[model samples]
Target chain A: MAICTGCSLLCEDIVASFENGSLKHAKNLCRKGHGHFQAAFTERTRPMIDGEQVTIDKAVERAAEILKSAKSPLLYGWSNCTEEAQSEGIALAEKLGATAEATIACTTSFCEGILMERVLSGKIETCTLDDVRNYADTSIFWGSDPSSSHPRHLSRFSYYPRGEKRQRSYEEERTCIAVDVRRSPTAQLCSNYYFRLPPGGDLPFMEAILAVLDGKIPKVADKKKMIELATVLKKTEWGAIFPGPGLIYSLQDKMELFEQLLARLNEITPFKVVPMVADCNARGFNELLFEKTGHASSVSFNGGSAAYGPEHSVLAAAKKCDAVLAIGSDPLSELPIGTARALAHQPIIAIDPRRSLTTDAAKVVIPSALIGLEAGGTAVRMDGVKIKFEPVMNSELLTDEQILARIMEAV
Target chain B: MVSAMEIYMLLPKTNCKKCGVATCMAFAVGLLGRQKKVDECTPLIEEKKYEAKLKKLREVMAPIEKASETGLIIHPEKCFGCGNCVVACPVNVAAEPTRTAVGLGPEGEKVILRVEDGVVVVNNLKECKRFGPSGTLCNACTATCPSKAIEFV
Candidate 1:
C-alpha cells in the first residue's frame, strides 16, 4: 500500500508497481500527487553552495555560518514535514534566537487557530471524516472547494459512499451544498444546490443563513434561495460544514459570525466544522502550537522571551529579519510576489526534495527526504486524527528532522 | 494612438498608495508599457464594469499577461472526486463532471486527470488566470500519494 502525500488527505489506499526504475502501474493517485511522486526522478536538488553542488557537510556548515553570523533569522516551513522535524526545527529556531513559522503566512490569523482553539477548548462540535461519511446526512462546503483541493473527499467521506448509517448514500441519504465565489468542482457536483456569493460576501451570506435559520427573511440578493438552504440546514440529521481559505481570508477579523452560525446550527441538529488546510500537517502544526503555545501562529521564542502575535508573523517578521531558513515550502511561488521577492533578496537557506523557485534562488539548498516515502513520522489529519507511518521507499538522504537537528547542532 | 474611451478605461482605480504612485490613473499610465497583473487593479476587478470590460482590458494589458501551453489533465479513474483539486487549484480548471461516474475504478478514487489520445491534455489552458495551470503541479496531492503512483513529467 502506498501513501499519497499530495495533500492532507494522506490517502493510504494506493497500488503501484515499480518497472524500469519508475512507477508504471498506479491506482488512486491524483494529478498533483502524481507530479509529487514523479518529482523523485526529476529536478532533484543537491547540496549546493553559490549554484555549485557541494558536500552535505559543507552546505550544512554554510547554512550554520549564515545563521550564526546573522542577528535576526526567520525559520519557516514546517507544515510539510513531520511533528518530530517540526520540533527539531523549533529547537533550532530557539537556539539561534530566530523567529520560526509555518509554510502558509500567519495562517492562524486566517482562522484555523480560532477554530482549533475552540475545538480544543470545547467551544464547538466536531467529528472525524470517517464519522462524517458514516453518519453525516448533510454536507456544507462553506467558502471551500474540496474538488480541486482534497479530490477524494466526497467519495471517501463527506458526500459519497454508503456507510454504516448512510445505507442509501448519494441517492437518498446524502445532501451536499457548496458556498463559494466560483462555481467550484464541489459546487458543480452539488449542481442546483450550489450557491454563489461575491468575493468577500461570506459575512452577509452567513447573516442571511442565520436569519433564515431563525425563520426571519434574510436581507440579501437571493432571499428565497437562502430560505430554501436554511430549511435544508434546519432539517439535517447530521450536518458538517467544511470551511476553506476563502472564508478565512474574507472574514479576517470577523470570525465571530462563523462561530455564531455554528452555535445556531447545533441548536437544531448535530453540526461539525472541518477546516480545509492546504498541507498534510497543517493540522498537526495547529495542534502542536495550540498545545505548546496556546496559539496557532506567530509564535517566537527569541532571547528567552516568547512573544506571539500577528506582528510576529512571517509576513511582518520577514521584513525585520536579516536571514531566512525556508524548508519544505515555496513561499516564492505561493505568496504574493512582493513578499516572495523580499524573502528571496535576503540571505536564504532552502531545504526541499525537489527544485522550486525558492530553492533556485536560495543561498543554501539542503535536499531532504520525502515524508511517508523517504522518511517516517507522525502527522495530524485534517480532522485531528494522528496518523503514524513508515517510509515506503528507501532513501539515503536526510529527513527534515535529521537536517533540522544537524542545523541546530551547527548553530 | 489612444482614444478618449480608452483613456477613461485606464483611469486610476485605487487611492491606496501602496503602489507609491498617487492615483490609479497614473498607475495605469505607468502600466502602459510595463507588466501589470489584473490583481493590481485591486479595486477595479470589483467594479460592475469588470466582466463587461474584461475583454478590452485584457487586450490593452496584453504585455502584462504571460502565455504558457501546459494545462492539467484529469484522470477520472484515480480521482477521489473530493474536489480538493478543484478548490486548491488557483485556476478554476478542475471542475465537477456534469454527469456522474457510472462505474469506473472506485466511486471516488476513480477521478482521473482528463486525458486525450495517448497523451494527457488539458483544455482551455490559455484562459486560466492562475499563475500556473488550473491543475498546476502544486504537488500538494503528491504529498499524500499513498500508492506513489502519481507522477510528474
Candidate 2:
C-alpha cells in the first residue's frame, strides 16, 4: 500500500501495481489522484538548463550558481514538498538571505491573524478527522466542498461511517450543513439545509447566526431558516466546522467574526474548527515554519532574523526578487496570470518531478522522484496528522530532499 | 427515471390554465419536481374523458423504491461525479493490474465507479464483489458518498 499525495487528504491506502516501466493500475485513488499518478508516465520532465537538455549534476550546478550570485533572491513553493525538504528549503533561504513563501501565503494573511496565532498557541479548539467520526453529530462544511476536494471526507470520517458513538450515522444522528455562496456539490448533498449567501456575504451570515444564537431576530431575508440553523447548532452535542478558501477569502480581515461565532457556539456545545488547507503538506509547511520562526506563512531572514509581512509574500517577492527557486509547486499555473507573468520575467530554477507551466518556463529544471510512489518520506496531512510512507517502486531519479541537499552543497 | 416527454404524453393537451400552470408541458415539468400531482388538474381528474390518461399518469409519476432491501441504489441525478465511491470501494482498490487508467476506456480499468460528464456511472457491475454468494455486504462506496446519492438497500 502506498500513500497518494494528490491533495491535502494524503489518502494512505492506495494499492498500486506497475508493469514494465509504466503504471499498470491503482485502486483507492480519486480522480485527482488518478491524474497525479498518470502524470508520472506522461510529460515527465528531463534535466534541462536554458531550454537545453543537460545532466542532473549540470542542472543543479546551474541552479546553485543562480541562487548564489543573485541579489534579493526568493525561495518559493514548499507546500507540496515533504517537511524535511521544506526545512532544507528554509535553510537555503537563510543561507542566501532571501525571502521564502508558499502558495498558502497568497490566500489569506494567516501570518498576522489571530487564527494562525491561536493555532500555533493552541488556544482554539481542534480535533482530528477520527474525532469527527467518533464524536461529532454536526459536521458543517462552511464554504468547503469536501466532495470535490477531500473526496473520502464523508465516508472516512465526517458524515457516513458508523462510529463508536455515532452508530446511527448520517441517517438518524449526524447533520451535515453547507454554508456556501453557491450550491456546490457538497451543498447539493446538504439538500434542504444549504445556506446560500451572496459572494462576500459571509460576514452578514456570521452576524445573522450570532443574532439567532443571541435570541434576536436576524436582519436577513431568511430569518426562519437562520433560526432553524441556530436551533440545530444549539442542540448539537459535538460540532466541527471545516472552513475552506471561500470562507477565508470572504472573511479576509474580519476573521474575528469567525472566532466570535466559534466562541459563541462553544457557549452552547462543544465546537472545533479545522482549516481546509489545499495542498498535501501546506499545514506541514506552516507548522514547520512556525516552529522554526514565529510566523506561519511567509517570512524573510535577510536582517539576521526572521521577518514576515505582506511584502515578503510570494506575490510581492515575485516583483522584487531577481531570481526564484520554486520546488514541488507550479506557481505559473496556480497563481494569478499577472503574478505568473511577473515571475516569468525572472530567472527561475524549478525542481519538480513532472513537467508543468512553471517547469516549462524555468531557466533551469531539475527533475526529482515522485514522493510516496518513488521516494519514501514523511508528510503532514491537513489535520496535522503525521503520515510516514515507503516508496512503492524503485527509481533512478533523486528525491526532492536529495536534490535540495545537492543544491545546498553546490551553493 | 421517467422523462418529461413521457409525462407530457399522459397529460391532456388542452393547454388549460385550470391547474394554475400555463400549459400541459408546464404541468408535466412541475410533476417531475413533485410540485404538481397528476390529480392537481381539475379537468383531468373531474372529466370522465381523461380517466385513462390520469390513471397512467399516476402510475408513471409514482415514487419508486429509492432504497432497496439489500445492495446499493444510486440516484444518478444527485451524483456530482466526485468519484468518492470509485476510490473508497475496497473492491475497486483490491482489483488487479494497478496502474493509472482514466476515462471510460476499457484499458487499465481499475475502478468500478466512473464519472462521465458530471454523473457517477457504475462501469463494471460484474466486478462488484458484493454480488457473490458469500453475502458479503460491503457498502464502502455507498457509505462514503458525500452527496447521499448512493443508498444502501
Candidate 3:
C-alpha cells in the first residue's frame, strides 16, 4: 500500500503495480490521482541551465550559484513537496537569509490562510476528517466543491460512508448543504439544500444563517427556506463547514462574519470548520511554518530571522526578491500575469519532477523525484492529520529533501 | 455512459426491428438500460464493416455486464472511493445504529457496498435491498454518486 500525493487528502490506501519501469496498474486512484501516478512517464525534467541541457552536478552548482549571489532570494512553492523537504527548505531559507514561503501564500493572503490561523490557534473549533465521518451530521459546503477538487472527500469522510452515528437512518440522516455562487457538483449533491448565492453573497448568506439562528425572519425573499436551513443547523448534533476559495475570496477582510457565524452555530450546537485547501502538502507547510514562526502560511527569513508580513507572501515577494528557488510549484502559469512576469525575469531555480512553465523559463532546473511515488516522506492532510508514506518505486532522481539539502550544502 | 444519440450513432440506424425492439432509439435506450444486447444488432455485429463500432459499443456496455443482483454496477476505474454509494445504501444504515451515529465502516457489517482500497466493492449481496423478490429498486447509492460511477441496469 502506498499514499497518493494527488491532493491534500493524500489517500493512504493506494495499491499500485509496476511492470518493467512503468506503472502497470493502480487501485484506489481517483481520476486526478490516476493522472498523477501516470506523471512518471511524461515531461520528465532533466538538469538544465540557460535553456541548455547540463549534468545534475552542474545544475545543482548553478542553482547554488544563483541563490548564493542574490541579496534577496524568495523560495516559493512548498505545498506540493513533502514535510521533510519543507524542513530542509526552511533551513536553506534561514541559511541563505532568504525569504521562503509556501506556494499557497499566493492565496493565503485572502483565501484559507486567515481561517487556517484561527483553526491552528484553536480559536475556532476544528475536527479531523475522521471526526467528520464519525460524528458530523450537517455538512455545509460553503463555497467549496469537494467533487471537483477532492473527489473522494464525500465518500471518504464528509457525506458518504456509513458512519457510527449515521447508520440508524436513510439519506436524510446526513444533510449536505452547499452555499456557493454557482451550482457545483457538490451543490448538485446537496440538491434542495443548495443555496445558490451571487459572487459576493457569502456575507449576506452568513448573516441570514445568523438571523435564522436568532429565531428572527431574514431579509432574503426566501425567508421560509432560510428558517428551514437555520433549523437544520440548530438541530445539528455535530456540523462541519468546509470552506473553499469561494467563501474566502468573497469574505476577504470581513472574515469576522464567518467567525461570528461559527460562534453562533456553536452556541446552539457543535460546529467545526475545515478550509478546503487543494494542495497535497498545504496543511503540512502551514503547520510547519506555524511551528517555526507564529504565522501559518507565508513568511520571510531575511536578516537572520523569520519575519511574516503581507510583503513576505510569494505574490508580494516576487517584486522584491532578486532570485527565486521554486520547488514543486509553477508560478509562471498559475499566478497572475504581472506577478508571473515579475518572477519570470528573475534568476529561477526550479526543482520539479515534470517540466512546467516555471522550469521552462527557469535559470536553473534540477528535477527532483515525485513524492509518494518515486520518493516518500510525511505530509499533513487537509484537516491537519499527519500521514507518513514510503516510496513505492525507485528512481535515480533525488528527492526534494535531498535536493534542498544539497542546495543548503552548496549555499 | 453516453446519451442515446451517441448510442444511436453507433447503431445501424436502419430502424430495423431485427433485435425485437421497435425503433433504433428504443434499442439505444434498451442498450443503456441493459435491456438490449449490442450483439443482438445483426448489422453491427455480423458485418465486418461495423467491427469498430461493435468493439466501441462493447467497451461502453461492458460495465453493465458486471452489475450484481441489484443491477448496481460500479466502474472501479472511475471510482475514487468517495463513499456516496456505501453511505447512501439503506441496507448499511438499517443494519447499524447508535455508537454516535457516524464513523461506521460498511465493510463487514451493515451494507452490501463497501469502499475497499479506494474503490467501492459489494459485500453481503443477500442483505441488499435490491436483492430477492421482496427487494425494491432502491438507488440511493447510484443517484448520489457524483462521478456517475455507480449505475443500475
Error of 3 at B68 (Å): 6.8
Ranking 1 against 3 by lDDT, winner: 3
| lDDT of model 3 at position A27 | 55
Worst 10 residues of 1 chain A by lDDT: A98-107
Model 2, A1-411: lDDT tens per residue? 778888888877666788877777675565667777777787889999999999999999999999888877777777788888888887777776633322223222332233545666676788887788779999999889888887767656777555668766665798999988888878866787899988888999999999999999998998999999999999999999988877877666786788898899999999988788877777777787788777777777774577776677777878887888888778898888888899899999999988999999999999988887888888988777999888888899999999989988877
Residues A1-411 of candidate 1: C-alpha lDDT, one tens digit per residue: 777677788777655555565666565565666666766677888999889999999999999899888776777767788989877776676677644332222334445666666676667678898888778999988888876787677756786555668766665778899888988767877876888889898998888888898889898987788888988888899998888888877756786888898888989998998888778887777777666667665476666656776677777777777888887677678767777888989988999998999899899999989887789999888888888888877789999998888887887
Order of candidates by TM-score, top first? Answer: 3, 2, 1
Could you say which candidate leads in DockQ? 3
Q: Please, what are the lDDT tens digits per residue for candidate 3 over residues B24-138?
A: 9999999876677787899888889988888888887776766776777778777756666665667666665331124234424545766554567777888877777798978
Which 10-residue span in candidate 3 chain B carries the lowest summed lDDT?
Answer: B98-107
The candidate that wins on lDDT is 3
Full-model lDDT for every candidate: 0.68, 0.75, 0.80
Clashes of each: 57, 9, 15
- Candidate 2 pairs with clashing backbones: A24-B98, A24-B99, A25-B98, A25-B99, A26-B98, A26-B99, A155-B144, B69-B153, B70-B153
Counting only residues 3 or more apart in sequence or on different chains, how many pairs clash (N, Cα, C under 3 Å) in candidate 3? 15
